[model samples]
Target: MRQKDNGGHVRQEDGNVNNSPPPTLPNLPSRRTPNFPSDPLQILRPDSSESRRAQLSEPSRGRKGASLAAVAMTKPQQQSPPSTTATTTTSPPPPPSTPPPASSSSSLAKLPLRLHSLASSSRSLLAALRRSPVTTLVAAFFLLALFMYGEDVRTLAELSIDDYLYPDADFYNVSALPPLLLPPPTCDLSRGRWVFDNTSLPAYREKECTFLTKQVSCLANGRPDDLWQYWRWQPNNCSLPTFDARRFMEKMRGKRMMFVGDSLNRNQWESLVCLVQPILSKGRKKIVKRGSFNIFYAKEYRATLEFYWAPFLVESNSDNPNFHHIDQRIISPERIESHAKNWKDVDYLIFNTYIWWMNNEDIKVRRPNSTSWSEHDEMPRIETYGRVFKTWSTWLEQNVDPASTSVFFMTISPLHNSPAQWGNPNGIKCVKETLPVLNYTKPLDLNHDMRMYDLVAKVAKNMKNVPVSLIDITRMSDYRKDAHTSLYSIRQGKLLTPEQKADPQKYADCIHWCLPGVPDVWNQILYTRILSKSSPPSPHPPLPPQ
Candidate 1:
């Protein structure tokens, strides 16, 4: 018969215990049992009733066997009882002396539970991202675009304000900028003196140009004093800006500018061409003469500087540039359509007609119907000048578009035929005059008919539609008595003879100015006027699409 010990180990009725090892138990912290106090003498004693009760009440058979084996090993074998005295009653084994078997199995079971919890959290996160894909894509694209185009967006914003204020200045990197707050240029450009500075002499050489006339080529005709070329015009209240040839050419590019009037206008036209020619390369310019029109074309700039010979500013028989006699001057005062046809399309027109109208002879006027000339001596010089200018002004009002064209009338260039006009009793003419008259505090009395100037001013002022600016060059030119061609002028491509040269008072050309001289200053003033009145450049072309 088999009997169970209190430690759950099986024992024979003969009192011999079976010593087999117990089965392994699953590791679980909650199933672990507390360790009891160990005793060295417990193995020799019989099991108590409480131990027997615990062995019988153990839940799993495998766990009960493991616990019983641990207890048997820790307890020593008890002294065997006599067979006759051992009545059928079996003794229970003592409690375990080692740690409980559940302790090791409990720790092993905790790892799998922790691993299951982490996998459950990962699945929940993946489900949330899959629900909304469009929002995720839009956010990603916005960040990428900002990274690629950030600089370009910033540059466009900065240029928007800069381009509004300075429209044309975007292309060139100019070194100096004009003052933001500057007083408007006044009409008194002629109120200053001629200052002597060698550095400012001769804007261009006379021999370099093929269009230069011998009548005005004082340097080419061998004048003694070179100091006349160095004098610069300075206004009283403000300083005159220096002429920049490159800048002027840039302004005149693709434009047609004409000087319309007498040979005096030709003098100024040549002066302007020479002033700007040095900045252009060779073969870049050409001169074309067609009828009464003389054109200087700068090829690179596409600009034409032209002179049309209309000395009286009307249709006259003296319009023949080559062979017309000065005494036979007759004008059709009502008819200017012939000359205005060529002048209408020009961008800038500088009209001058003064010295040619100063003749005291009986003037001849051609009426529309009458074939015969009508002589008028009773009409004063001012009335005749006014009638002709009225015809010109009427033509301007009818034809010229003031928005597209700029019109200027150069005042009468003064003549220095009589030195007595400047209080010089001994000096009769402009000959032998080396310097400007400095001591004469009073204005020099001139033979130039001032009535013509008054007529021009009146016509320009009265015009309501057409705008005309009068470039008053008279007073400034009056002080330049030393700047004339004088006895040094070339007559018909020939130098004056010794006899003619001896009497300079008779042969002196006190009318036209020497080249690289006073006319250059006039052009400088013209340049200033052009700059002051000019509109800003057009807007920049639109940028290409990205």
Candidate 2:
């Protein structure tokens, strides 16, 4: 019989050296014979799945020699000759014997193979990332920012899909944040400062030698007709034609207009109605508020003209007497959104909020959401106002759609209490000056007024699609120096005391315009802006109350 290779030592089969030895190793010098069980030679043959599993279980044995690891993993079919011989059927045995070559080790030796190289490179990258976390995170953030910048550019170039799908959508227009629209505004320091001096006043050659004084003796107890006639005589150059009660009634016959603001806003609204109500035969005009906040509907024009007195336009606690004066109580963006639902769906949206925000030391508005200012607060008034308006405009841009509605931001209605601007620093208290007169030697420095101008421009700039027009009544109205009700003296209608009649310019009501007075000029400008194309002669028959 041919000598059989015992299960005790390494066997050489057809030039292949396979290790399937007994416990004894020739390299070991210890010759003491310890009775050891015969090694299973068949285990190395890979003929049974159990043997193959057993072989993989010993990673150290599998990795003994570099060649053994390579042969065991690569060309496993050829290395495991017994298994190849055992499987005579078309399908080969599960040769999971080669543990599918672990992803880590084989990837090490076969560094030249693209798949292995890729795996190795990935591991190296992971290790490198672990070493420099900050740098990796910063690089990732930079890349993300670059991606967002590109996305913004794309958004500006085309209408976003969200725009069309949500027609009533109120998305803030980022473009409105820029100062681009300010330069193009028609009213500004240039026009406002241009005063009509003794020489420049001649621009108008009046029929009378009475040298049209921009100032006129003001009225007390309100004379509607005289107020109407006075403003027509001195219409601001930038403004539209003077108010014609008859004509305005006809023009606004069926139209609806609204003014929304605080008590001051109501002052103008009441002045406007009084001036025009006289033009209507008694029962033709009525003043009514139907589910309207501060709105006033006049009977003659059939116009539902009204005023909504939401100074901030956001709902907040009104119970606190100081709520109106406290800066901290001012509504925040999140708070404003809570009330945005009520402001929508209007033909023309007019907004004004200034005096309400004039919170100074000792006067603080404390909203549950906003913090009260302390001595440590250092923010500028303009900055605070800018931020507030920014939030407001952003919400406006997001909620209002220009396609169906028109938006307007009226320039802050100037208060006549500023003696320097009204040409009466000491004696005049806005009550004595009634008639239209040029009392100021120069145009008032409008730093306070320009804040509103700049804000409107800023809002217009950042807005997209919405053509927000500015009703710049500030500069236009600034020219009427004597128009204020100075010292409460009636000029054109009521009889006055000898003392009152003697100094007509001393007792003027400075705050409100003589409706049928200068404010009519503002309304005319508004009309020109809205109804210019048609320029319907002031509507006849007056608007009926709605």
RMSD, every candidate, angstroms: 43.6, 35.3
Off by over 4 Å in 2: 1-229, 233-239, 242-255, 271-285, 289-292, 298-303, 315-334, 337-340, 359-379, 418-426, 434-442, 446-449, 486-509, 533-546
Question: Candidate 1: TM-score?
Answer: 0.64
Give the per-residue lDDT digits (tens) of candidate 1, residues 427-509: 85898888887755667788667666787898899999988998889988998889988888765546677898888877888
| C-alpha lDDT score of every prediction, in listed order | 0.66, 0.44
Model 2, residue 505: distance off in Å is: 15
**What TM-score goes with each of the models?**
0.64, 0.46
Q: Which 10 successive residues of model 1 have the least lDDT summed?
A: 4-13
lDDT of 2 by residue, 1-546 (tens): 222111111111112222342122223232232221121110111123443333333433332323333533463222222333343456756553333355334423343354554788878876887899986798689778879675444432222211111122122343453321222224332143223234322212222212111122232233332332433423333433334455555544554456665544555555455545555433223343323243333333344455665565544333121123333443432356644544564555666666555544222223343453232233455665666566677777787766655677677666565555554568444544444444446556533546646876887777766667777677656666555444433333343556774563444445554333455455555655664433333222222122
